[model samples]
Target: MNEQEESNKKQKTSNESTEFLNFDYEFPLDAANVIPPENSSIPEDLFTFVTDINDIAPEPPLEIVTRINSQRQQQQRQRQQQQNKPIVPPNQGVYTIIVGGKPFRLSWESLKSDGPSNFFIEYFKKKKTRVMQIDRDPDIFELIVRHLRGYYIRSTDDIQNQSLLYDATYFGLNRLKKLLQEYSYLNVGGRVFRLPWTLFQKDGTHNFFTGPLMHSLLSPHTEEGNSPPIYIDRDPDIFADIVNHLRGYTIHIRDEMHRKNLLKDAQYYVLRQLSDKLLTAQQTVAGFGEGSNAEVLLLLQDVRIVNMLPPKVTNLSIPNMLISQDWSLTQIQYKRVKDGTPHTLLVQVSDLCMQIHKSAATVKLMYEMNHADIKKMNSMANMAKATRGVNMEIYIDKYCAITIDDNQVKSIEYCMENDLIDTNWEACTKCDLEDCQMSRLILQRAICGVHLVDNMITLCALRLEAISSRFRLNLKREFLSG
Candidate 1:
């Protein structure tokens, strides 16, 4: 163990340390399989240090550099060309359109943006011709051309309106179609009913009113004018109700007569929804629950009794009758006892008549009964008696009096003989009262055994009975005296 031995040993240890620290760790084909060294004193910065591969640059071929520079120049030229390209104004160009043997000059810019216009423009451009033929109505084409020129159209004729719509559809003029649909109005029975075009063109089943309206709006013969209205042959009031419904408003039909008319018109027009609405309205106004027949018949009986009264009597009014229960005979019977006389009794009858007439519901009921079918009336009468203990005889007798005028007795007899009364009562009932002499002679010859005065008395009695029943009256004493 000498100085030489110690130095040699130290040198061997230093060499081993250098070899371990320099560890030429090549990235293995499967680096995941490499095992980490247990422990080492190598500085962390030395392990993280990266070599500058970019510092060792190699010269590229001249041909490759030339090709790359050429591509860059080509892209620069393209960008300059794009920036310098010309912009054509929309209104700058002109085009010719041949529609229905007529040539129309249109703006190319205007035609280029629209469906039909664009189609024709492209067609002409492809054919390299300025003149393109369109097999559309010249008038309709003119309208489209005007619209393209920013002119609004207002049409009233059904044929022209329809043709315009057709042309719009063919040409794909949605804005024009929408304009026409938005502005169409109807003139029905001398009354104008305006509605939104969308309502008539809704994509489903339509009512009688809308069907005709749509047809009229779309008919080729339909004319276009300045805010023109399509003429319809229909009752104005009923048409108004239909229009209200289409407009999404709640139908507020107050009068039963109006309701009936609306119902009839709805049926005629095949407005199923409106018909359903009117039917519901009828039931509601009649105060009859759904499917209840007896109360309706009873109301009809009351109506018949009221209709029998003379027009003068029906028009009379009794103030406070609706609020005052004392007006009933039960309350007034004892009061009238001391004042008993023919005059007093007549006054009481007059008051009772006024009370009945003053009731709007009662008046409506009476009108319904007056116009009710004869056979239907008889059936309703029978039904009423069976269901509600109503006296059908009273209703029958009233109907005979009010409906059968003395002057028209001859006509009535003729109608009965010919069975025309069953078919058309309105025609049979309408008679010339001024021709009384002729009517009286005819009545005497035709209805020899019919006593007109007795029938009148019976009709009066039936009415009195109704008044008594309605007001809960104990009018037996006054009624007997009258």
Candidate 2:
């Protein structure tokens, strides 16, 4: 197809989209509601119940809305606004518009759907372009934009109005300049400013480098003083969405880490038990029972923790690669005693990593001990700076001991026998884990399994953050000095 033909085809599609969505919009009078508090990230154990591919749920519903337009009395005379404001940028419109294939509207709505459109109309009066393309519906855009303006004002007013927070300009939207002038969010020096969807794309997909008015918007998570959910005017529903998404991601990662932890622990239990079993077999060889040498020989064929993932993932078998003279009779004897794999497979434990290995056996590490190892490993993790956080096992095992310094190792292995009820190890509730992690580990007894999960999750978060270039830079000086 030629250029004009392709243009005609594209226009036909655009026209169809516009025709499908156009509708009358009511102008709202009231300001938008300030957002609710931010939510925590997703949990790790959320997908534990799911076992097969059939267990996965379906996709969520997508919002399909219409643009809305309404006429209302002016809030202020148009001439008064023209004198104070700068000329509107070429990229923006005084009223709603369609620029570069995306919808861009400037309408407002009150708490109710049909309310006054006065402030919205007046606000758009002094701008350069005042085009609003007709679409299937106009109400949705008006309402959504009205809410966006309100959020922009609420989140940015402090910085815009020259409060002590003026330096904290990492969250405001860049297109609407008046928000900062009238409200508190400043227009300049904002690090992470969100742009309209229309500006965020070229061919279609969001442009990472050039789309955002400010670079930080694309990288908001690490931006300093970015109270993101607060600034983004996060819906409580979005938190739920985030939790859902995070659970999928975290579960995959957490389950992997946890499985390794559990398997290692399970394997350790199996091996240790098998070691005991081996000791029994050895005693049989030394002791002279009916199956004496036979029992010892039989055990060489027994499956141990060191040999597998688990019954859930896989069931391991004695490798043909391993065999011996005593082992041959042992295999035959073990097969004689059991119909399936040995139960000693789950008895391996970490405390006996050496004993089982030297006995021509293998051991899996304990999860509890592994958690301690992760804490220690993370402390020794390659980092550009020093950091501390709550350790989960320490929380369950030692009451959420805070690591005051890099050398704070005693907290992880604190004796449950001695430390429970010890007044020194408890984490305070106020810090929300953050404050609790920075303080000294006061030994106390308040061990809980859920707290163990939370502490370990907190540990993962800390490990991630400790090496995070952002966190490392923020805490580097102290880390270096110590």
Candidate 3:
């Protein structure tokens, strides 16, 4: 009731109004829950019940819902795109081609894109099968696959090239065929000889291209390229002549060296017909000045008769006896002997004096005596006269004759008496020796008769000796006597 109490109440009211103006203002929970003027400064303990609660759920914002709707539209559009897309087969990426009963996996896109592989692509498209069967060798297919993959094929083996050609033709792979056709070019000693395959179709027997030479050139084992050409270890000129012959060109080799080299190549490559032709040509050329009637007298020392035939003979004449020194027939004289006989002789003689003389009719001398053997016989006769105290003389005349019919000897008649052997002895002492001489002469006549009919005759000297022994006389005694 006093003035001082009134003043204090007024002062308190002014301080409270100043504090209300300075504090941050927040909207009331409701108009009824307003703070009372009496309790303007609320106690911190009274608001302890208003603690934060994290468990209560709240509705999503409108912006979040709009974004979720946009995401749903995007998903729907993606699904539509998936449904509208073209259906691709599971095996479309890869193709399985069966060759030689084996599966070969390849890219479908690559097969379809390749020009040569169109046939396979069309076939695969026509048949929707997963596996396509093809009848082809697996090894060849491997090569084809390599070629398809853009690898350069450099195989030069003839067999492999032939196989590849067959496959290429079947598959319509013109590129591979062209490559094979191009292989006919031969690289002989840095010289490029382009020989077409068709050029060798003539006379398949003599054609080097059609025969083993072609096989060697195209052999797959041989590496082929521009840097390292297919090497031929032969004379280039000789090979050129061979190529010319293969190309249906008449090969007239004027150079003897070239001919000799060519002959060697021909023999090596098994070009038998070509070898024969070359030999005949060489023989004709070598015997040009020599008369046609001039006989080829082959005095064979250690040479085989068969080895002296055409091709071998040609080789012999080249570069001065290319075959062997023992086969030298140039030293033998080819002149008609004593009588005016119209016969050219080919005699094969050895130191044993067994003469194989071939003329119009073959005359083979089974037993012949040289001057030394005659002297030996004469000495033996002289020794017999001195030691045995028996005067014995034996002489062999030069001229003798025998008759032959078929392969068997019909008769042996000497041109003169004791033409082969002449002996002077008593009837009883010379009986055995005379019988042996007669038997030996008959055997010699038989051998000559057999040789007359047949070019070759096999006569055993042991059998003749046995026959002579059966006559109660040894063949050695007969030889000593004459």
> Could you estimate the TM-score for every candidate?
0.36, 0.16, 0.29
Residue 97 lDDT in candidate 1:
84
What's model 1's lDDT at 364?
Answer: 10
Give each prediction's root-mean-square deviation over alpha carbons: 21.7, 39.2, 23.1
Report the error of model 3 at residue 49, Å.
75
Candidate structures ordered by lDDT, highest first = 3, 1, 2
Q: What is residue 465's positional error in candidate 2, in angstroms?
A: 41
**Residue 263 C-alpha lDDT in model 1:** 71
For 1-482, candidate 2 gives per-residue lDDT tens digits of: 89999999999977654433342223552232222113323347756887766567554444321211111223344556666775533323335555334577553332112222232344344544456443323333333355455543234333322321222222132333333323222122223332333322321243222334233333334536443322333233322322233233321224334334333332332323223333232222322354423222212113322322111211122222121223221111122212233321111112111000101232111123345434443432222011333332211122233232232333332322344212233343433234231123222112111111211221111110011123333454564464
lDDT of each: 0.44, 0.29, 0.46
The C-alpha local distance difference test score for the whole of candidate 1 amounts to: 0.44
How much is 10 displaced in model 2, in angstroms? 99
Candidate that would win on lDDT: 3
